[model samples]
Target chain A: MKRNIRLLIEYDGGRYRGWQKQGKNADADTIQGRLEQVLSRMTGEDVQLIGSGRTDAGVHALGQVANFHTDCGMSCGEIRDYLTRYLPADIGILKVSDAGERFHSRLNAAEKTYCYRIAVPGVPHVFDRKYLWHFPEPLDMKKMEQAADFLTGRHDFKGFSSIKRTKKSTVRELYAIDIEKKEKEILISFTGNGFLHNMVRILTGTLVEIGCGRKQPEDVLTVLQTKDRQDAGMTAPPQGLFLVSVKY
Target chain B: MKRNIRLLIEYDGGRYRGWQKQGKNADADTIQGRLEQVLSRMTGEDVQLIGSGRTDAGVHALGQVANFHTDCGMSCGEIRDYLTRYLPADIGILKVSDAGERFHSRLNAAEKTYCYRIAVPGVPHVFDRKYLWHFPEPLDMKKMEQAADFLTGRHDFKGFSSIKRTKKSTVRELYAIDIEKKEKEILISFTGNGFLHNMVRILTGTLVEIGCGRKQPEDVLTVLQTKDRQDAGMTAPPQGLFLVSVKY
Candidate 1:
C-alpha cells in the first residue's frame, strides 16, 4: 500500500545548492536530491519528495517540512532512524509521520518564518562563521525597527525578489517583523504568508542599510511603490538566513 | 624597543595540526604557526608565541591565552587589528595587551576551564555538528554526576594522558567538575590547576562511558590508581572539546 510520509527536517545549508534539485549539479548536491537518493535507496524504488519552499543556497532550516510517497511497509520510526543513520551530518530528520494521501507540503502551507543573524562589532565565535553575517560597528536599532514596521503588511514585493520572469503575483502578506538584539548579535525575524526568491535576504539587506544610516526608514515605502529591484538595498548573503518554521 | 605582549585567542581548530607549531608542516598550518607568521610579517621580526598549553588538533578555544615578545612599537589595538586582518577566519585575536616582561601565559596561569559538548538522543541542529559530539542515546546523568564527583580534587591523572613517555609528574589538582544539561546538549566542565596531554579528552571519554553504563562511578578511582592508559576508556575526539577559559 502506498502511503504519504511527512518529514520535519533540519539542515546546515552551507554545502548544498539550495532546496530544489536543479542546474547541472542538481542530482548530487541539493537537499531534495539528497533526500530522494536516501529514500530511493531505503525503499528500493524512486521517490519524489516535495518541499514546502525553496531555501536559497547557504540558507539553514530548523523546521522545513517535506512530503514523499512510498510503497514501502516500513514504520515511520524505522524510516526516521534509517535516514538519520545514513544521511550526512549536516542534514537531519527531526520528525516523521504518516500523512493523508493527498497532502501537499507546499500548497497546504499557511505561513512561514525566516530569521537572519547579524554578528555586530566583530565575529567573536569562530565556529559560527557559517551561520552569521558579521556586520561591524553598532547599528541604529530605532531606525531598523521603524523600517521593519513599514514592511509588515500586504504589498507587492517585486523589488525584493530576484525573479523577473514569473507570471505569479509579487504580492505577499507579511504578518510580523521582529527585531531582537542579544549581546553582539541581532536577529531579524519575519513571518509572512509566503516569500519570493531572495525576498527575505533583500529585505534584510534593506533593513541593515537603514540601521547603518545608509537609508532612511521612509525610503522603504518608495522602494515598494516603484516595484524596481534596482532601487532596493543590495542582497544580503545567504549564510545568515534560516527558515525558522513553516505553518500548515 | 622590545615589549612583552599577551593575547587572548579564539580559534576553530578543526583544520590545524594543534596549538604548537611542530614537524615539517610547521609554518604552513597550526594555530601557533599561523599566529607567528602573521606577527612576523606585521612586525618584520621573527616571533615566538607561547600558549597557555598545547591543545590537540581539532580542539577549539574561546579564551586560550598566549604571550609573545616583539620589538615593534605598534599600539596594542593596532596590532590586534593587523592580526585580525591577516589571520584566517578560523583563528582570531580577541584581545591584546602589554604584559610584564617576565609574565608567561602558562607559568602564571592559576587555573583553566575546559568544556565538552555532547549532543544526545536526537540531533536537532545540524550547524552544531562541528562543535558537538553526537551520542544518539540517553545518558544516565546521575551516574555521570557521581563519576564527576569522584574526579574532583587532587588526583594523579597519568591514566588519562595519551603521552607514552614523560618524566613530569601527573599529579594534578582538579578544582571542580561540573556537569550541566542544556536541552539536548550536555556540557561537561572541568576546572583544574593543569591538565596532561589529552587529559581532558580522555577524562570526558571515561565519564561518558560511565554515563552510558559501560563503567561504574567507582571505577574512576581504580583507573587513577592503576596509572595505565589502557585501563581507561577510549580518548574522546577533539572536536567536542573547548578550552573555555584560562586564568592568569
Candidate 2:
C-alpha cells in the first residue's frame, strides 16, 4: 500500500541552486534533489518529491509545501525524524502528515504569500545582509503604496515574468499587497493565487523604482497593459525574497 | 594636532577571531586589527584602537565602542565615510565623534548591556542559528529568573570569569537582569558597570543549567561564595552572545 505524504518545509536557500532537480547535475545542490536523496535512502526506494513552487537561488522558504508517495512501511513521525537527522542543518522538515490520494502540492495549493525586505536608510545591518536588500537611499512609502494599489487583483503578468515563451496562462490573481515599515526595515508581502517565473520580484522592482522616484505609480498600468517583459522594472535580487506560506 | 576620537562600531563576529588585536598576528582577522588597518591606510600612519571590552571569538556586537587618537587631517564625516568604504562588509562604523580629551573607552564608561539568545524547544530557526544558541530541551523560566535575582548587585564574580588568574578586580555591579521570552526563544539581557572575561557567558550557562533543573536557584550564591571556576556551570558558546550597547 502506498501513502501520499505532505510535508511543511523550511530552508535557508543561500547554498541551493534552486528548488528543482536539474538534469546535468543529477546530484546538484538543490532543495528537491536533497529531499529526494534523503527520502530514497530512508525508504530504500526512489522517491519523487514534488514542491509547491520553485524558489530561485538565494531565496528562502518558511512554509514550502511538498508531497511524495511512498510504499515503505514507515510512520510519518519516523520518516520525519529520519529526514531531520540526515538532512543538512539549513533544511528542516517542520511537519509531516498523510495527504489525500489525489492531493498534489502544486495543483492543490490555494494561495501563496511572499515577503521581500528592504533595509531602510541607516547604518548597514551586517548580519541581516544575507536576507535583506540594503538600499541606502530613503524610499517614499507613499509612492510605493500607491504603486502597490495598482498591482492588486487579476492581471496578465506576462510583462513581469522572466520566461520569454510559455504555454501556461500568464494571468494571476493578486489578492493583496501589504507594505509595512518596521524600525529600520521595510517588509512588502504579496498574497496571490500563483506567481509567474519572476513576477513577484519584478513587481517589487517596479514598486521600488516608484518609491525612489525613478518611475511613477501610474507606470504599473502601462506595464500590465503592454504585456511586454521589457516594459517592467528590473527584477529584484533573490536573497531578499521569502516564500512566507502556502495555503491549501 | 592630535585629536581624541570615539567610534561606535558593529560587526558580525562569526569570521573574525575576536575583538582584540593579537600580538603575533599583528594583521590578524580581528575587529580591532581590521579597524586599525583601515585607519592606518587612511591616515598614512599607524593606529591603535582601544575597545570598551574584549569579545570572545564568534561573539557579535551592535554598539561596541572604541576610542583612539589620530593626527589625521580628515574631518569626522570624511573619516566615517572612509572607514565605511574600506572596512569589510561584516564590520561597520556606525558613528564617529570627537571625544573629550580625557575620554577613554574602557575607563570613563558608565554602563554596558549584553544580550544572549537561546532557542527553546521547537522547530529550529535555521537563519538565526549563526546568532542564537539552539537548546532543544525545555527550560523553566521561573527557575532562570530566580537564579538571575542572585546575580544582581555587586559581587565577586570570580567563579564566572574564565581567566584562572587576574590582576583586575573581580567585583562588579550588575544593575539589571532582564529575561524575556519571545515565542520559542529566550533573551537574557544584563546591564552592568563592567563584566569580567567570559562573565556574561558563564552567567548565561549557570542560568540555563538552573532552568534545565541541573542546578538550583541557591546554587548561584554557593558559586559566588566558593569563587571557584568549577563551581559554576559550563561557559556557553560565544556565538549566542552580543555586546548590545556601551554608554559613556
Candidate 3:
C-alpha cells in the first residue's frame, strides 16, 4: 500500500547546501538528499521527497515542511525513530504524520513565515553567533517601520528580488512585516502568501538601509514602481535568516 | 611597569579543550591558549591569563572572568579591538579593564554561579542543540527540588565530585540550588563560594537520578555524609553545563 507521509523538520542549515538534492555532493550536502537516502534504505524503495521551498545555504528552519511517498508498511512513529537514530544532530524531526494521498506540501501551502535576527550594537557575538547577523550601527526604528508599512501589501516585488521572470508574474501578497526589537537583538518577521527569489532578504536589507539612514522610507515605493532589482538594497546574508513555518 | 588587566570572556567551548592552556596541542586546542596567542601577538609579551576557574572541555561560559599582567601600552579599547579582530568567532571578550595589581580572577571571586540546561521530552534538538542536554524522559521536578534541598547548605561535597582532596578542606558553602522549568527546558542553577572538580556535573547527575526515581531524594545526604564518590550518581556530560558568572 502506498502512503503519503508529511514531516515537520527542524535543521541548523549551517552545513547543508539548502533543501534540494542537487550537485555532485547530493547525498552528503543537501537535506533532501540525506532524507531520501535514509528513507530509501529504511523502506527498500526509492523515495521522492517534496519540499515546500528551497532555503539558501546557511539558512536555518524551525518548521520546514516536506512530504514523501513510500510503499513501506512501517508506522509513522517507527519511521520517525529510525530517522532520528540515523540523522545527524543538526537536523531533527519534530512531527511525522501520514497525510493522505492528495496532500502536496508545495501546492497546498497558503502562507509562509520567515524570521531574520539581527544582533544590534553593544552586543558581543558569543555562542549562537552562527544564527545572528551583527549589525553594529544603531538603527532608527521609526524609519524602518515606515518602510515596512510600504512593503506590506500585494505588489510586484520584482524590484526586491534577484529573479527576472518573464513567464510568471512577480506579484506577491505580503500580509505583514513586523519589526520587533528585544534587548540587543532585532527580529524582523515576514508573513506572506509567497516570496520571490531573495525577496524577503532583499526587503530586509532595503529596510535596514532606511533604518541606518542610507535610504529614505519612501524608497520602497520607488523600488516597487521601478520593478528593478538594482533599486533594492543588498540581500541580507543567509546566516541570519530562518524559515519559521509553512502553513496550509 | 606591569599593568594588571581584567577581561570578561564568553565562549561556546564546543571545540576547545577547557579553559587552561595545557597539553602539547596548546594554542590550537584550548580557550586560554588561543587567548594567550592573540594577546602575545598584540602586546609582544607572553601573556599568562588566569581564569576564575577551569571549566570542562565541552562546558560553555557566558561570563568567565580572567586577569593577566602585561607591559603593553595599548589602551583598553584598542586591546579589545585587537583581541576581537584576532580571536575566533566562538570566543568573545565582553569587557577589558585595567584592574589593580592586587586583583586576581581566581582569588578575589566571592561567589560563582553555574547553570545547567536540560531539554525535556517532546522537544527537538536543532540549531542550539550543542548547548542543551536532551533527556527524552519527563522529569519529576518536585523530586529534583527535594534532592536540591538535601544538597544545599554548607557541607563537605566530596561525594558529589570526582576529586580526592586531602590537603584542602573539602567543605564548601553551597548558598542556593534553584531549579526552574520553562516550556520544554529545565534550568538548574547553582550558586556557591566554590565548586570542586566535576562537582556541578556530578551534583546535576545525582539530582537527575533522584528525579527519574533511580535514587531517593535523601540519597544526597547519604552521599555527602559518606564522603564517597561511589555513593553519588553518574557524572553528567560537560556540554549542558555553563559557567554563568563569577562575582568579585
Candidate 4:
C-alpha cells in the first residue's frame, strides 16, 4: 500500500547547486539528492521525493513542502525521527504528516510566500552572510514601498520573470507585495497563488533600483504593461530570496 | 613615517587554519595574510597587521580590529573606498580611521566579548549551517544558567584552555558570563580581559552538558578547582563561537 506523506523541509541552499539533481560535480550536491539519500537508507528502498517547487541555487526555504509515497508502515513521528537522524546537517524535516490520497504537494497548494532580504551595510554580516544580499549604500524605504504597491495585484508578470523557456504559462496572480524594514535589514515579501521563473527576484531587483533612486515607482507599472522580459530590472542574487511558506 | 590606520578585517577561517598564522599553515591565507596583501598593494611596502586575537579554523569574525603602518597619505574615507573596491567579496572593510601612532588594537583593548550561538534542532539551518552548531535536543536553560554562574569570576581556567602548548600565563580574569535564550537559539556571551585558548567553547560545552542533565552545576566548580584539562567538559565545536567585539 502506498502511503502519502507530507514533509516540511528547511534547507541551507549555499552548499547545493539548487533543489534539482544535476550532473555530478563533487560540489554539485542538491537538496533533493540529500533527501533521497536519507530516505533510501532509512527504508532500504530507493525513494524519490517530490517538492512543491524548485528553488534556485543559493536560495533558502524555511517552510518548503514536499511529499513522497512509501510503504514503510511507520507513523508520522517515526518517519520524522528517521529522517532527522539520517539527513545531512543542512537539510531538516520540521514536520511530517499523512497527506490525502490524491493530494500533491505542488498542484494542491493554495498559496506561497517568498521573502527577499537585503543587508544595508555593504559589509557582509559575519553571521548572516549566507542569508542576505549586502548593499553598503543606504536605501530609501519610502521609494521601495511606493514601487512595491504597484506589484500588489494579479497581473501578467512576463516582464518580471526570467526569459527561460518553459511549458507553464507565465501568468501569475500576485495576492500581495509588502516591504518591511528592521534595523539594517529590508525584507520584501510576496504572497501569491504561484510565481513564474525568477519572478520574485526580478521584481526585487526592480524595486531595489527604485529604492536607490535609479528608477521611478511608475516604472513598475510600465514594466508590467510591456509584458517583455527586457523591460524588467536585473535579477537579484539568489542568496537573498527565501520560500517562507506554502498554504494548503 | 608611521601612519596609524584602523582596519576592519573580514576573513573566512576555513581556508587557513586560524587567525594567528602558526605551524605548517602559518604562511597560508589567513585573515592577516589577506589584509596584508591588500595593505601591501596599497602602500608598496611589507605590512604587518596585528589582529584582536587568534580565532581557530572555521571560526569567523565580524568586527575584527587590526592596525597597519601605511605611508599612503590618503584620508580614512579614501582608504576605505580603495579597499572596498579591491578586497574579495568574502572580506570587506566596514570602516577605516586614522588612529594615534601609539594605538594598538590588541594592547589598548579593555574588554573582549565573545558570543557562542547554538541552533537546537537536528537539521542545520541552510543559511547558518556554516556558522552555527546544530544540537537536536531541547536544552534546559535553568541548568545551563546555573552551570554558567559558577564560571563568572576570576579563576584558574587552565582546565578550559586547549591542551596545546602556550607561552602566555594561564591565569585570566572573567568579568561576566551570561547565557541568553531567543526563540530556539541559545547565545552564551563571555566578557573578560582575555580568554585562554578554546576557553569560551569549553565553557559552553560544560554548560551544554549541564543543560542536557548529564552533569550538575556544581561539577563546573569542581572542574575549575581541579585545574585539569581532562576534568572539564567536552570542547564545543568552533562554529558556534564568534569574536563579537574588542573594546578599546
For every prediction, compared with the true complex, DockQ reads 0.57, 0.47, 0.57, 0.38
Writing each residue's lDDT as its tens digit, candidate 2 over A25-131 gives 67458999999988989988889998999999889999999999989888888888888778887898899999999999999999999999988755566887788
How would you encode candidate 4's per-residue C-alpha lDDT over B126-163 as one tens digit per residue? Answer: 55666677766678998888777788888888888885
lDDT of 4 by residue, A198-234 (tens): 8899999988888888889999898889988787777
Q: How well docked is model 2, in DockQ terms?
A: 0.47
Worst 10 residues of 1 chain B by lDDT: B120-129
| Residues B1-248, model 3: lDDT tens digits | 79999999999899988998786467878999999889988888978889999998999999999999999999999888888877988999899999998999999999999999998755567777888887767779999998898888999998988887678888888999999999768999999999999999999988888888899999998998899999999898889999999999
Docking class of 1: medium
Model 2 per-residue lDDT tens digits across residues B132-239: 887767799999999899999999999998878878889999999999999858999999999999999999999999999999999999989999989899899998
Model 2 misplaced regions, further than 4 Å: A23-28, A71-82, A136-143, A213-219, B24-28, B43-45, B71-79, B213-219
Q: List the lowest-lDDT window of 10 residues for candidate 4 chain B.
A: B21-30
TM-score for chain B in model 3: 0.97
Q: For candidate 4, give the lDDT of residue A113.
A: 98
Maximum-TM-score candidate: 1
lDDT (10s digit) by residue, model 1, range A1-248: 68999999999899899999985456768998998989999999889999999998889998999999988999998999899888898898999999998889999999999999998765465778778887765789999999999999999999988988788999999999999999868999999999999999999999999999898999899889998898888799999999989998
lDDT scores for all predictions?
Answer: 0.90, 0.90, 0.90, 0.81
lDDT of 1 by residue, B76-120 (tens): 999988887778889988999999999999899999999999997
- Which ranges in model 4 have alpha carbons more than 4 Å from their true place? A20-29, A44-48, A119-121, A133-147, A162-169, A181-185, A208-223, B8-12, B23-28, B121-124, B135-144, B163-168, B209-219
Write out the backbone clash pairs for model 4: A12-B126, A122-A136
